[model samples]
Target: MIPEDILFEYNAKIKAFDKDEKIFSENEIARNYYQVLKGAVKMSNFNDDGKEFIQGIFYKEQSFGEPPLFINVPYPANAITLSDSEILILPKERLLDLLTKHHDIHLKITENLAKRLYYKAIIASEISGQEPMHRILRFFDYLKNDVHELTSNSSFKIPYTRQQIADVLGLRVETVIRSIKNLEKKGEVKIISRKVYR
Candidate 1:
């Protein structure tokens, strides 16, 4: 992600949002570059049956909704604040200019996009063909290894709730709870005071 000072130098502005506030809607024109300054945001969409499918959850210092800027398309999902949050936003033109002048930052952005693409590909495959346990493990592994940079076999506390995990993995919350218990019984994960750790 771009440094705070650099973003500010390029005229980035920080805006506050209440919990569950929509930062932008699906199909909205991509006119700004957004980075979470505090709290979190989830990029998601609802199905015809009103079931929510979460595209991704971004925490502090992470950027979201950038693919549209690169592709010249509208946002594919809605971005909503998960809590009272502050977000730094830069105009699309200014962001482009900032990237043009900062090669390292541009490369970093490209790398981040590539990581997201890889995650999407893996998740797509898992959802289409894998069992529930396999999907859950793969999802946790990606978040631990790729996103959190945790070493294999180390205990990593899951940051998301069961409902959030179910939404992200296209499963029901009850299924997620059952799977977590199964995983615990198999020693794949530990349930410590109702929190899951892997």
Candidate 2:
């Protein structure tokens, strides 16, 4: 993520959004770079039956929807605020200019995008045929090591809800709940006061 001061220098504007507000829709043209300043945003797509499939969840300092900006294509998913949030927005042209003048920032952005691509690839494989427990553990491990950058085997709390996990892994809510409980019984995870820990 670009530093706030650097973003401001690049003509970025900070905008606020209410919870559940749509920042952009599927197929919308990507005209700006968006980075979270506070709260969370989720990128998702819904099927014809109204079942939502979560592409990803982004938190503070994380950027979303940049692949389309780089390729001059429409966004593949919708971005919605998970809570009342502030986001820094920079026009595509200005962002490109900034990147050109800042090679380090450009490299960081590329690295961030590469991590996201890797996560998507791993999740795609997990969802195809893996058991529910395997999928859940893999997802949690990704969050612990990659997203949160924690290395210890000590407890790591999960930030996502069961429904969100279900959406991301293409499983039923009941399945996620049951799988989590089974994991807890097997010592793969810990649940205390209804919050999952890994």
Candidate 3:
């Protein structure tokens, strides 16, 4: 929640991770806060059968894996680099100390965590439904609302690939591709080449 400069001033270390690199595995003890400086990261967990269940995909300037650091528990999911990315690592104790001094930073962290909880509630219902198309559309709407300027019917581009969408939505990649095509035909969204806009 603190600015980049403040993090660098307080027990921060810069690390570069390659795509597909495991930043931390499931059940690992969370001792640090991570802020992505560039590229992307995905947090996920695998089922007993090895099927991946994506928690979320984070892009530049986004932070991940905070709950365990606060609660003194292990990480519930794995954090992996989705692209070659630089991360600023802040130790848990140092971060907690910093938070006590910065009221605005503490408030920002609370606000962001609340937003994530709200998103999770929305997706919980989306995935439990039988309609893959609606689930996909709802997720698209969520993404647009999250980081873009939205008007009544303004269009925005989706940042993730079809496979990424499927993993997050608990659908097959083929299902995502097919459902997107259908959405395009229905004039609900438009896809040009591989870029998806809704």
Candidate 4:
């Protein structure tokens, strides 16, 4: 569990947003970092053609926006709630103060950043291979590692839509749908009432 002192020290507060609401816009100053208390948030960027490509999906209990906070720059991607969500917001000044006072928290932040970098590297490598099925599998593997209870027999509740999944995986929506169908046909996965069970 996260420490209450940390929350207090950072002057954090729980914030709520409705579905399809923008948490932060691209090029907006990174004023605060947010941790999802419930639901999902997607980080995305618009291409020259004005098509949005998802950088990632952050689920409940996961953190986002810290990288830009330390860099003193606008957010590289826009953050939007996938559903109604509760988030804990830690403002920049308070976070810096906490880092100055708590070595352990600083270490934890560094560790989290390192892990994200590692996952990004793996994703980049898979993308270069241009195999949509492999990309989807790799994404599933990452999510399974990050969130507990996601396994062969576990119900993997995907918080994102098919188009969102395709954007995140850098695959065509048709290909993503086909891959999901293949997995279902092989009995490797099942979609029951829109929830995926593996």
- Candidate 4 stretches greater than 4 Å from native: 1-5, 147-155
- The count of backbone overlaps in candidate 4 is 1
lDDT of 3 at 109: 92
Off by over 4 Å in 1: none
lDDT of 4 by residue, 1-198 (tens): 235557766688998999989999999999987888888888899889877888888877678877889889999899999889998888888878878888897887787777778778887898888577677766776666654435555566665677987887777899989998887788766788866654
Model 2, position 147, has a per-residue lDDT of 84
TM-scores, all candidates, are 0.97, 0.97, 0.94, 0.85
For each candidate in the order shown, give its overall lDDT on alpha carbons. Answer: 0.95, 0.95, 0.88, 0.79
Instruction: State the lDDT of candidate 1 residue by residue for 49-132, as single tens digits.
Output: 999999999999999999999789999999999999999999999999999999999999999999899999999999999999
State candidate 1's TM-score: 0.97
**RMSD after Cα superposition, model 4:** 2.5
Assess candidate 4 and give its TM-score to the true structure: 0.85
Tens-place lDDT per residue, model 3, 71-154, is 999999999998899998999999998899888999989988887887899889989875999999988887888644376488
Leading candidate by lDDT = 2
Cα RMSDs, all models = 0.9, 0.9, 1.5, 2.5
